[model samples]
Target: MSGIKRTMIILPATLVYFLVMLDSSIISTAIPQITDEFNSLLDVGWYGSAYQLASSAFVPLAGKIYIFFPIKWSFIVFFTVFELGSALCGAAQSSPMLIVGRAIAGLGASGLMNGILTILAAILPPHKLPRVMGLNVALGQVGLACGPLIGGALTEYATWRWCFYINLPVGALVGALLLSLRIPEINTKPPAYEVLHTAMSSMDLFGLVLLWPSAIMFFLALQWGGNQYAWNSAMVIGLFVGAAITSGLFLTWEYHYGDNALLPFSMLRNRVIYSASATMFFFMGVMLTAYYYLPIYFQAVKGDSPLMSGVHILPSIISQVLVTMSTGTLIQRVGYYLPNVLTGTALASIAYGLYSTFSPSTSVGKWIGYQIIGGAGSGATSPGSYIAIQNSVPRAAIPTAMAILILCQNLGSAIFLTVAQSIFSNSLQNHLRTQAPGVDVQAVIQGGARMLRPLVPAQELPSVLQAYSRAIDAVMYLGAGLGVAAFGCAWGLGFKDIRKKGEEGK
Candidate 1:
């Protein structure tokens, strides 16, 4: 590919990836409004779960599909499909329908991380890959960092539905730009029959069958356990057992079948890949858990409106964008990954620790400081992790390695939020019982609305609100603990700075 062609492909691909990522976090602050509008707080959990589950379930599958298809056309197919899903979400009238739409979008989005990476590797030299990947990472961070602010503004000034609707035009434009660019095409014809035969011979069909159920069951169990069902209830127990059994089978299958496997066990054998993937899992979990729950602390405990809550979270997003941009450019210049990883992780750990001290009485200045620390940490680590993983592997292993990284990330995110929320509930109940002896702690815990709204009697409202604040603080503290663990994992990352001109230049 020539300079202009490469620029066109990279720039547009970056934009599309950014928009998809933005969509993931954008609707969070609007959840309360959606729940209220639909009168289905019970179903709100599905909104996030549907997207996450679909993305996790199908991402690896997309990786396999890319083996038999052109990268350029595959992207066009997936991005268009994703845009269609987004449009459906914007037009959705019911909670279930919205979830279905989100799932469809997830299905398309499942392909994105791997898609861009594959394209970058094919066109760019090994050394230049990091800088391009860094650019991709920066674009994604831009989406993540800007999501809340954009979502909040849209939700506040117009409507929450616009959050999903907004993706349509952006996606279309990105797709158009990518399609118009004339890029070099690889001449290898996909050995579809042979690839399929090999895939069937080597792949674990049993594991594939078990994968979705295990994920779905585990997610549902988390959503319901403690919040909807008692931890020891028959329903929760059955779901948990099903998830464990299915997951065990999947693992066993993967272990037995290495190369022809859906998940290559040999890829996991790479020390650097293993360590980097594990670190990604831990931090992705911690970061996502915070994203899901932090706004609740602002809205439920601090009495901020949804739009205001989103606005409040904006600083962290903005700071992360700035940090990621600088980090990306520097990585292009530096040719190593360790310094950024160590520095970012150390800063993030401190930020998370500081955030754990949050209370209703915590000042705005203090909150901003905490967010800045965390944002900068995020900026440093996000690109740093991707660069490490991409740089460590050879071209042959790139797709599988990227797939594992994303899978670990999604699974970590799903597991952490479920576990974190469970921890929060158990702690909150204990705190409420001791503090408000006569209050209906169960009611307040189950529906947090009574604690949030002005409709509740003014006399008991203060105590209820106070309890809510304490509960929020406890969850934040718990998240902080998780973040500290993530930072420790981040510190373990072998940082090798790969500068823009390549490692040889340094």
Candidate 2:
């Protein structure tokens, strides 16, 4: 393909990715509004977790689907499903309805993201792939960074629903352009139901069944324990036990199914693939915890409006974008990724540690500087794992490898967010009891974070703010620990020079 043609194909696909990522991050700023509307502050984690759970569950299956189906049609179908889900979210009347909509959107997003990367892998030369992939990733980060700003503006000026509504037109345009473009297909099998059915049977649907419930049970256990039930209560314990048993069964099934498994054991054994996935799993957990909670700190604690909260997050976003763009070129020039990964995680650990020290009286300069350090670290390391996996795996395994990587990242987000929420809620409740015993815990929680100032008496506001600050700090401390673990995983990525392999076509 000519340069211009490649650009045309890549641009629309990147836009679609941007839309997917935007939907994921946009809800951060709108969480306060959504919780207030539904009167369910405890459901905050579910807003993001539901999406990540469904997306993580279906990602591997979507990779298998792309391997068997026409890539173009698969992408269009996924994009359409994503649009439908967004429409449902925009029209939702309750928190449960919105969670359901997010789940649906996540299902489609899993396919869309995986399909886009698979298409790129098929079309691009190995030597030039890093730069293009970098561009795609950078654009997605742009969407992620802008999500809070967009969501805040819409929520303040119009309604939180516009956060979902905005996806409609952008998605429509991207879908139309994709339809006009000819996306080359690597799957030469005939496009027939019989073929699809055979492929589907080989996809290990039973394993998917086992995996979904395991994840849902695990997240529910985390979300409900301490808040809705005692940690030792039968309900929470049962859920934990169920998750463990189901997960074990799922692994056994995957082992038996081997190549036909949802996540094939053969691929998992690859050092580069698994280590890189592990690195992303921990790194993303840290990155997403900060992304979701930083807005709350700005709006709920610092008294910024939603729009201003977005503005406050800009330092991190700008640093991330700049680092992401530069990291790609750096990787292309250096040919190795482990050093970048190590360096980035080291900085991330320090950043999160600094963030944990933020108090109600933290200065603007201090917060901005902290965010810049964290963002640069996160953006610099984010693409290393994906590039490493692609370089290590064969073309036929690219879809599966990418799917596994994405699955790990989303799972990290889902699991860690739930853990963070649990920590935040429990710590807040404990601090509130000690700091201001007369305040109603349930009432304060239901009133939502941003509404705390008006709901609490003036005398109690200080205590409430202090409790919130401590809760947020607890989460940040957890992020710092995860960053340390990510750094450890980075060392296991096996020191391969991706550019050298690309040049040799090995």
Using lDDT as the measure, which candidate wins?
2
The C-alpha lDDT values of all candidates are 0.73, 0.88
Q: What lDDT score is found at residue 251 in candidate 2?
A: 95
* Residue lDDT tens for model 1, 339-392: 777677677777767766777788999998788888888888887767777777
List residue ranges in candidate 1 displaced over 4 A: 42-45, 182-189, 193-199, 202-206, 424-451, 495-506
TM values, all candidates:
0.91, 0.98
- Evaluate residue 155 in candidate 1 and report its C-alpha lDDT on the 0 to 100 scale: 78
Residue-wise lDDT of candidate 2 within 328-372, one digit each (tens)? 788888888788889889999999999999889999899999999
With a 3 Å backbone cut-off (N, CA, C), the pairs that clash in candidate 2 are: none
TM-score of 2: 0.98
RMSD to native for every prediction?
2.8, 1.3
